[model samples]
Target: MADPRSQVEHEEEDGASAGELLIEACRRNNTDLLADVISSCGGEEKAAEVLNNTKTVLGNYIYHEAALRGNYEVIDMLLDQEGFECDPINTREGDTPLHSAIRFINSLPPTPPSPDNEPSAAYNLISMMLEAGSDASIRNKANLTAVQLLDPRNVELKRLFQEAAEEAEREREIAGLEAEEHEEEALEDDYAGSGSDSDFDPEEFKRQQEEKKKELAELKAAKAEA
Candidate 1:
């Protein structure tokens, strides 16, 4: 992995960035460079942080750049990392990466889509985003989700979004169940550390009672003599 530290320092002195290498890697489908630089920076999660924090000139996140460029492998690299934000809205357009991908497809010249071609590059991109738990219901500044922006004639994309939405819900449900199970387990461990009155041993109780009675009898005798 090429250390970007020196490049960063040089850029600082001249107020010129060395260029966005990760974006370039995605642009060229260079996963090896992507993995090298990311792993070199840190592990998956740390690399995700660095990439997500950096944006294009358009103020779009790394995911946005990858999706717009139709870089599936790059998107997978970033999205597979833990704690990635799949649905990132660009500052200028208030459009999530899904919306960006959709808009890119919509802008293409009209063509007769078939099952052989209905799942266009745009469909695949949006599907990937949605599968990663992107919220399809989230509205942009225009109060439209990415699905809403689609041409009514494009039934394929709409149905794909619908499936993605369902898959996202299932993912959320599973996550919720896992969290609940963890909470329940913690509660059980906490309770196990705290014994109830019923937990007292009979033999220990009898021994304690006998000792207390003996002490009381001695105290009463001493008081009477006094």
Candidate 2:
């Protein structure tokens, strides 16, 4: 059997094999051939077969090839399928596909397309992986979270990952707050509509809230006086 990388690279060169073809199509952003292949291979099922089960005799998915090439659509296609592994650490280095992509981004020699280029594809893909459930907290064999995978040399890459992590945390907090607010609003609405003042006295509720507010004011006043 061919080496895993060789198999992907060879088929990538030849435009043969579904996996190789899909990776190429994704790299080129050729949604046309992508659609055709999806049609023939039974949509996501055939794609999953290559991704989940097929490996070079050495054991690697063609999907990993797509990721290494920075093909976000292919990543999205695989992720949209149920149960596809978003965080497969390679046997060679215990690095997930996200790690591989970040590694590539960091190691590139300075040239025309420098790391400072606007709105990095790597950041976009990493965001996709995170959204698809890639765990930020998983320490690699190096005991580093995927965020730490960024090269210390590339301050920009580090900043990008930091921003993405912060954004994810902010979104989670926003979602939690929204959920709490929704629950509180629902409870208020329910109480207002169903519980009669005679059955559940408004005066009693007002008195309790007023007392609580007064206590809070006293506590603040005491703290200020101190």
What are the lDDT scores of the predictions, listed in order? 0.66, 0.61
Quick one: best lDDT, which candidate? 1
TM-score of each candidate?
0.62, 0.57
Give the TM-score (vs. native) of candidate 1.
Answer: 0.62
Predict model 2's lDDT versus the native.
Answer: 0.61
Considering only N, C-alpha and C atoms within 3 Å, which residue pairs clash in candidate 2?
none
The ten-residue window of minimal lDDT in model 2 covers: 1-10
In candidate 1, clashing pairs total 0
Per-residue C-alpha lDDT of model 1 across residues 114-203, encoded as one tens digit per residue: 656546666677777776777778798898988998877777788887766665555565566556556655655565577555565646
Model 1: clashing residue pairs? none
Candidate 2 Cα outliers beyond 4 Å, as residue runs: 1-37, 45-53, 69-85, 111-135, 189-226
